[model samples]
Target: MVCVKNLSFRLQKIILNDITLSIEPKGQIIALLGPNGSGKTTLMNVLADLYQKYEGNVHDVGKVQLLPDYAYIPEDLTIRECFNLFGQVYDTFNIEKAIQIFSYLNLNQDQLISSYSKGMKEQLHLAFLLCHDVDTYLLDEPLAAVDPLTRDILIDLIMKFKTNSGVTIISTHLIQDMDKLFDEVIFMSNGKILLHNSVPQLFEKYPGLSLDDIYKEVNRNVPFN
Candidate 1:
């Protein structure tokens, strides 16, 4: 479960202002949506405990892990080495799960991380995070640098976590297929939440429009059909 009330953060200026929301304690996938500099990443960072000097209250139960947009391991280490290192650092890290993910993604564990492409690196980072036993995952741009096949695989893996009551908040600019991935959506602008609703509610309110269209409509502040 994750809850934020009257939260505001600043770094010389306001980044997130007077935001309040609560996420259910069960299986849920939340999409954090907005255009450039809209504070999506800032909100994720706050929830991840990366930034502490903020106003208002933030509360969550169980383990919370963050997957940053640029999360990377030591470049010189092989994939297996990275996993081994993670096991040493985190008691929650599971090698069996890690191996399964690597196999599913068709990643070669013996290869040096430096030799992998950007997409490959993204997959590795996801594998590392998904190997953890956590209640909440704050993933920033999990689909940023991957092909459609890899993206689909990642989505499948994420959805499986729902059965275990894991909550995932994904921040992304790429909204293609979001309708299939997000259980709920939060629209933000200029460091403030514009709207928050379940997918069914959103679709019912804006009939005959995809998520992409709905986002555009919301941003333009136009009446829904």
Candidate 2:
């Protein structure tokens, strides 16, 4: 279980407002639905203790691992070298596991990351992060840089990660395509939670509406300002 209660963050101005959330992981994947600059990154950062000056009580979480908005690997390093470096930093990093993941990408481990394309880098970054065995994964836009075909592959990876008895919160703008895959959906806007509901509950409430339609309806009733 992970809980954030009465959380408010400030950086020049209040970014997270008074937000609260609870997550129960164990083959559970939650969707953090929001648009660009909707406080998704800020909330995840606070949970990761990247920002300490925030007002909040974050509790009951263990082995929290965050995949930040930026890739942490060095551009000049080869894929194998990057894995070795991260393996040294994280005790949970499994070289064997990382190598197995790379088998899918067909990437040359000897080549520098600088030679990879944006989408390739993005996929590699995610693959690297999955090498760590952790309880919580904060994935900001996990599918941001991938093409349609690659997106399916990454989604499969994320699904497999769910069975690891960990909680995964994925922040993404591709809500329509991903909504049905989530156990629950959290609609966030302007630093506030507009709604939180299980996918089934959402369907029950909206009846025949699609996720995009539901989002529109929720936003219409809520004050995004």
Candidate 3:
């Protein structure tokens, strides 16, 4: 499990405000749902330990695993280079899984990521993340810049990861297409959690409402300030 207490961060302005939340261990996927600049990505960065300029604490409470690590794929890395770099760093890279995904995505190992299309780059990033063994996976906008087919593939991998006991956290703005995969959805606005609920409980409280509809409702009724 991961816990954050009294977390407040600022980047030229406040991004997260005294946010305290805990993510359960496994058997679930958590969706950090928010619009652009709503602090979803910022919070993900904090959890990933990509940013230290913040107040409060982030504690990883779990067993004595060999590698209590988190993986974050940068958008700039090449497909081939990222594999080698991460392989050397993590030492637990899933080469077989990587090969399978590469073949499925039709990505050549020699090709530079700079030459690939946006969709292909996204595919490469997802492939890299899947081929790594990590306790927590923090993905930012996993569904963006992809065609429908690639989107489905990404979702499939995420589900597979969750089933295997990996704590997965995804930050995304594409609500309608991605909401069904979330076990729990965290709605954020103006750098704070406006609401959080499990998928079933969400539907229970707001009867007959889709995730997208609930997002709109929350934005309308929940003041950002």
Candidate 4:
């Protein structure tokens, strides 16, 4: 399990308050939902080990694979070279698997990432992350800028990951499309977790309401000030 105990972060005097969360092991899919500037990205960064100057602790008992919001794929490197570099760094790179994923995603091995479109870049980033084996998957806005068709493909890939591997934590504002895919929802506001419940439990508590509606209602009355 990945545990966040009283974790907090501050940026230029704007304090992101304390937060506590526990993510169960593999086979669980947690979707994080929040409005813009609500510290969703901040929390993801902290969990991904991108932000180390914060307070409190984020403890992961197993390997965690984090997919950041804007992963920088070197503009000069070819697709193949980038995969090779990542493999070397993680020491678990599989050239054949990488090739298979490229074929599945319809990505050209010779194409440079700098020349790919924004959506393509996002897809490549996800593919690269999946190339490694890990216990927890942390994805930040995996569906951003992706078309609906590609979104389905991405969702399929995630489902396969969970079936073959274990847990995945996806942070996104597009909850409506993902309601069926996630097992639970983690709602956040003002740098603090507001709700964490299974999809069915949340619906049962607030009948006849969509996740988006719940989000709007919560944020509308948030005591942020």
- Largest TM-score belongs to which candidate? 2
TM-score to true structure, per model = 0.91, 0.92, 0.83, 0.88
Per-candidate alpha-carbon RMSD to the true structure:
3.0, 1.7, 4.3, 2.2
- For each candidate, the alpha-carbon lDDT, in order, equals 0.83, 0.82, 0.74, 0.79
The residue-level lDDT of candidate 2 at 216 comes to 79
What is the lDDT for 138 in model 2? 83
After superposition, the stretches of candidate 1 with alpha carbons farther than 4 Å from their true spots are 161-163, 222-225
| Candidate achieving higher lDDT, 3 or 4 | 4
Model 3 CA deviation exceeding 4 Å by range: 61-82, 104-106, 110-115, 161-163
> How would the candidate models be sorted by TM-score, starting from the highest?
2, 1, 4, 3
Ranked by TM-score, the better of candidates 2 and 3 is 2
Error of 4 at 190 (Å): 0.8
Clashing pairs in 4: 26-166, 26-167, 27-166
Predicted candidate 4, C-alpha RMSD: 2.2
lDDT of candidate 3 at residue 88, scale 0 to 100: 81
Pairs of residues clashing in candidate 2: none
Q: In model 4, which range of ten residues has the least summed lDDT?
A: 158-167
Per-residue alpha-carbon lDDT of model 2 for 143-173, expressed as tens digits? 8767888788788777754436877888998
Q: For model 1, how does the per-residue alpha-carbon lDDT over 1-225 read when each residue is reduced to its tens digit? A: 478999999998899989998887567788899887788999988887888999999997468788887756899999899888999999888888888878877778899999988777777777788888888888898888788877887787777543368678889877876569888999988888899899899999999998988999899963222
